[model samples]
Target: MPDQVTPPPSMHWIVPFAASLSEPCQHALPRLADAKALPNLRRLLGQLQEVARIEGDEYALSMPHERVLAASMGWPDVDGQLPWAAWWAAQDGVKLTADAHWGLLSPGHWLMGRDHLTLLDPATLALSETESRALFEAVRDLFESDGWALIWGASQRWYASHPSLQGLPTASLDRVIGRNPDVWLTDHPQARTLRRLQSEVQMLLYQHPINDTREQAGLATVNSFWLSGCGPVPACTATPAHIQLVNALRAPMLADDMPAWLDAWAQVDNTVLKQALQAVDAGKAIALTLCGERHAVTLATAPAPGLGGRMWQSVKRLTSSRSGPDPVALLNSL
Candidate 1:
């Protein structure tokens, strides 16, 4: 179990985009992040006791933050096949057994360009609950006919279960957003079927009235879906209810909207980072994981930093609370 988590035994806040910005985005944010504007971020860094730095390639099926979640829940890292739909469906009150294969299906638009196809973030679709369900229902028969049982999870997340989804390696939605998805596709026989299904879905919804109305209103129309989180219900410790995955920076960072990203960071600095410092000052152990594009650095106020105390003894580098990477540099490396 490499890169295992050594979480401080209290509130754990997993803040993505603390360093996950794209190369261009990374430069802009770090340049603007002076010590004065980010008081809590700087102050919180001063208390970091131990760090479990996790690394994976940017092209890996799973993102660094997803790896952190798998480690936190004590699940084996299988790249992209972590059965996310099963867990999410269970959270949404769907019953499950150990044998069924589950996949999370998110419906969104794929921006067709001359050279590459880009999958937009699901949130960018702006589909209402009613619209999402309608879109799901419209395509329900297509998937059900192929033996997948489908359920509507939320506007941005849909769930499906079928035996064939087992062991099918798919890209994490985070990995492919804002980039061409073809380059990230793993070679799996089942993936070809999925791609055919993607085409069928595009044709099915291309002339549908929802897309027509959406085009009229200037919103991105539903074109295709990105599927990931494929596998059986893994046998492991339950996904922690305590970890707060602060996602304020995800959308804007993916969209390359720097203003929104900075605004989101400002909000996070005020709310999440400020509260984290308060917890530390109160003598409570807290864990903060800063996730970036290819690496994730998890810091805990664990008092002791050692091989036994750190995660993935093979992968970590210890830093004193006083001497860690420069805040800006840390963000850039991630």
Candidate 2:
């Protein structure tokens, strides 16, 4: 058998945005005066953060950080990365410092620069509330037309001003952004699209029938599974558990064996396996490769960074821990 393997269905780049503002809404008490408006916004932002974090953790690559976004896109950063000191020195009346800004945030989304398109102007505070509201609707329409979802603000109760969400589930148009009372939210097309897309991505992973045709054509490839964890799986993401599961596999598997592997996983811990599968299917992973009997999954199409000694340490921990059966010891016995 060949030792090297070819790539499979690859992962798409996940563009990230910092809703620094979102943190407040996520942690805020939902029973406030605007309780109805709070739940959806919270849900949407939490989901986006989850998506970004999982992608980053699984790939061993950081997503677009705030500093990267600001510097790359010619935007300002709060960390004085924008040469604002030089600008202030050159111009006598430039009173804008990072601390005093209101409408715009430093280190915004990467798309603000590279996307060659503008969705919404965080800096459009100068517009009258009504004019700003209209502009926001236009931006929302632009995003929907292009198939990008605004994952951050989806949950905020808002009404539709743009025509893009004419057929989608929507909140009343009366809900408004507090800063721009004139700008009303339509059905939060961005957030809606994101959820739908995440669900679709998961379906592609969990429900994909084996591509027996592709395999029979002799175009398919697979490898033995392996896992390496640096620390106890963080509660924040999926890499730890997914890697552990792969490491725990006693033998190689065919691509068609994924359902059986999942069944075996349920025997260990049903809830963890289920949630882990859902998140991995949705976010970082795109496909599994079939070896003879066991499947080797790829986080993306890219080969993973070689595992280090920490992975061995994790295996040791797995063998010694009491939380579940000793998968390492079991695999060793096999």
Candidate 3:
């Protein structure tokens, strides 16, 4: 007799920005407010909120991006101790020990307004790979001279490593994007050293040819670098075994582009959500987890019960006057 083959584990669909649908998209997406407009999403979320076991709390909703990262990487929390640098390094095929702390060095423009300093979106810098490398080279010696090791990961993400960064808590990029970096700056012992490096890097790039070229081309100057993701690789722990993340809505959502966000949502609803519903209908055991800045809600198909059990549930519902969560209300809250 042939040996029996085991089936693969069920897939878990993780959707970010599920709750915080952009306000601009609201008028353009009035149907989204009507749960019937997005039946797949509404049905899946309603089922999950009604039946599936939930993890994390309302606070987890506040940083949906970091929450997704922590859950995917099996980190404990989004607190400053999240090992974002190590996680990012791993993505670049570089391995760091649990004790090797790291920070992301991203070029950004600092806008000076009345009584405040705003850090523009790093993406708005529109830095090409050639220019990013040039700026990195000019300041590479500054970090190296201070006994730190710099590694270029991508056009926008450079890394700096130092032993002193261990146990230092740093804010995630999501928290500082389009906000005052000074307020979100790390409040650790090593913060002063990191700030000094930022100052020197700014001065070095202030007069570089790259900035001159960018300014002449009407591009935001890559004047300063943001230091974040400061922590060593954390030990991996148990997490969802078969999970896929869908975050196509993030970019437009962050930029507050309602039309583009709506288009992206249409794609997600037609593609990812449609496939998920089909899988569930085919008797596959699957779960859909929708996350906002504050909460994460998981949904799965409920188990069938005996006839007597069904009757009991019906009676109890009529007697208790309790109903499951409202999907639209939940999303609006996020």
Predicted candidate 2 versus true structure: per-residue lDDT over 1-334, tens digit per residue: 3453423323222112111122332232121224232232222222222111211121111122322322333443332123222222223232322322111111111122342422222221232344323333433444446553321111111111222322222211111111121122223454354345323433332322322332355532110000001011111221112222222222111112333433433343344333333443343433321111111112232223246644664565467423322222211111
Question: Where is model 3 poorest over a 10-residue stretch in terms of lDDT?
Answer: 53-62
Of models 1 and 2, which has the larger TM-score? 1
Model 1: weakest 10-residue lDDT segment is: 313-322
lDDT of 3 at 254: 64
Clashes of each: 1, 16, 6
Per-residue lDDT for 43-85 in model 3, tens only? 4553333333234443221265466557666677646667666
Ranked candidates, highest TM-score first: 1, 3, 2
Candidate order by lDDT, decreasing, is: 1, 3, 2
lDDT of 1 by residue, 1-334 (tens): 4554545558889987665546668567765456566667776776675468998777788888888988888878888877677767777776666677888898988999999999888887778998898899999999999887888888888988877787899888888889987777777888887888889999999988988999999999998998988888776536687798899989888988888888888889899989998997786888888888888988887564465654542234343332233477667778
The alpha-carbon RMSD values of the candidates against the true structure, listed in the order shown, are 6.0, 24.0, 6.1
Candidates' lDDT values, in order?
0.80, 0.25, 0.69
